[model samples]
Structure formats: C-alpha cells, structure tokens
Target: MRLSVAVCVPLALANWLLFSLSTMWADLEPRDLQFQSPLAWLALWANLLGIALLLAVLWRFGLEILEALAAAIKQLFAREVDWPAWFAELYAGLRPLPLFTLPAAALWGAWLVLFYFFDHPGGYATDVAFQIAAHALGACVYLPIFYRWRVLTKASSHDPQISG
Candidate 1:
C-alpha cells in the first residue's frame, strides 16, 4: 500500500536518525549520569503508546494489502480490460490512517529517556537494555490487538450499511 510505504519509510528514517543521535549523546556524556527522578516510567508509557499507534497502522496496512490482492484476483478472473485503472481506484480508496505522530513521539521520548536517564556510573547499559526489552514486550502485546483490528476492519468494510 502506498500509504503504508509513505508513512513507514519516513518513520524508519526518523528512528535511525534519533538512534544515531542518542548513541552519540550517550558516548559524549559523562559515564556517571542518572535521571534525577523516575523518568524511565515516562519513557515506558510513551513507548507503550507508540506501540499502540504503530499496531493500528500495521493493521490497516495489512488489510489494505489483502483488499488489493482480492481486488486483483477478482479483476483477473473477470478479465478486466483496464487493470491499472482498477488498481488506481483501489489505491485511492485506501485512505491513509491518521497515525503519523505516534512513532515520532515514541522514538523521541525513548531516545531522550535512554540517552538522558542514567545517574550511576554503571547504569547506562542496564537502562538501555531495559528500553530494548520494554519495546520488545510492547511489540508482543500489540500483535494480537493488530490482528483483531484487522479482522474487525475487514468485516466492517464488507458490510455496506456501516458508514464511517
């Protein structure tokens, strides 16, 4: 789906940018650094929210791909004269879901927390590891939710009476 490609590519780039910057910052900072308070908790919540938003987009992207495949099959079976036109129509119908902000916010938040939240001399590695583990957990939690949303969206799209 164009929408997915458009949104995800930029997000991936941004993530890389932030990750690099964070690594640089971490390297430059004094070895002895830690958050004055429990800023990791804020990072945790932001990461969770980002995961939720990305899962929603991923669900929509999967559904759009499935719909396009189905449409292509139907068109092929019918021997449609203008397949490109049909595809263009389908692409147009695949409206972009509104979730461009979540990934950015999440990445920035996580970067800040990871690169800025260490006080002890030997805590940086542990904190970074914790961030990684938290993101992994978030992904695990989001998978099922994405699947459920995809199924629901597919069902609702099929029923013509359901509007918006």
Candidate 2:
C-alpha cells in the first residue's frame, strides 16, 4: 500500500507532463516558455528536470514512510510503548506532511489544468473537461485525509495499546 501511494505520485506527475507535452504546453512547442529574454530550450529542460527531481524525492520519502511505519509496528509488538499513544503520536507526526501534500497536489493539479484550459478549445465542452479534472484533483488530494480518518476512527479500532 505504501509503495503504491509513493508510485502513484510520480505516475500522476508523468501523466501531467505527457499531457502538457502532447499539447501546446512548454514541450513540443516554445510558446508558453518563451517569456525570458534568453529564451533557450534550457527553460523547458529545467522544468522537466524539476518535475523529475520532485517525483524522485517524493517516491523515496514514501518508501521511507513505509519503513518507519513498519518499525513503529515492530515497536508496538515488542511492548516498547503503548500502541495507542504511539499510534496517535505517529499519526500526529504524519499529519503535517499529508496536509502539505494535499495542498501541493491541488495547487499543482490546478496549475496543470489551467495550462490545459488555456490551450484547449473554449466552449461548454472545454469547461466540462476542466471541471472533471478539478473533481479528480480534489478527490485525489483528499486520499490521505481519508486514509488517516479511517485509521484513527474506522479501521479496526486501531488503538495502539498492546493487549496484555
């Protein structure tokens, strides 16, 4: 599950990049990225490089998060701490990270869709397409929130207290 979450971020990013490249975006065309005076292909390459680096960093972090969770579970089993308090603390620790992710994903997704809209054929159809992506973005960004909620409240009463 953790692996999948980490993989999905890059997959989504690549999908956005491909969408941009296939369109009149900074790729396969020089219109959007042509604002600078020195206007070089470097601008486009830099943007692509940034995306690649972001994806790699996020992927690695995701794996590390999984590893941390595994370690936490082991600690719980070993009676090093009360499972509930530790679980709650771990959840709290991870809280800020997920909140950051949701906003970042939403903002980036909005930026991508806005770029798409700028190049798309304007009409009711274009509006509809843009709206659909917006909905998807909202849904995707809420994933972490939902997962946390489930862990805290719904999923198997996941209190970390080790049963004696």
Best by lDDT: 2
| Cα lDDT tens digits for candidate 2, 1-164 | 33434635754766556554654244434645443334435655677777777667756685466547645554554344344644554455454555445555565555556556466456577667667765765565346544544454433344434331
**What's the distance in Å from true for residue 68, model 1?**
13
Q: Which whole-number lDDT from 0 to 100 does residue 149 have in model 2? A: 40
On residues 129-162, what C-alpha lDDT tens digit does candidate 1 reach at each position? 6567657645643454344444434544565433
Stretches of candidate 1 off by over 4 Å are 2-30, 52-56, 59-88, 92-164
lDDT of each: 0.50, 0.53
- Each candidate: RMSD to true structure? 13.4, 9.4
TM-score of 1: 0.26
Q: Which residues of candidate 2, in runs, are more than 4 Å off?
A: 1-38, 63-119, 123-164
Among all candidates shown, the one with the greatest TM-score: 2
Model 2's TM-score against the true structure: 0.36
| TM, every model | 0.26, 0.36
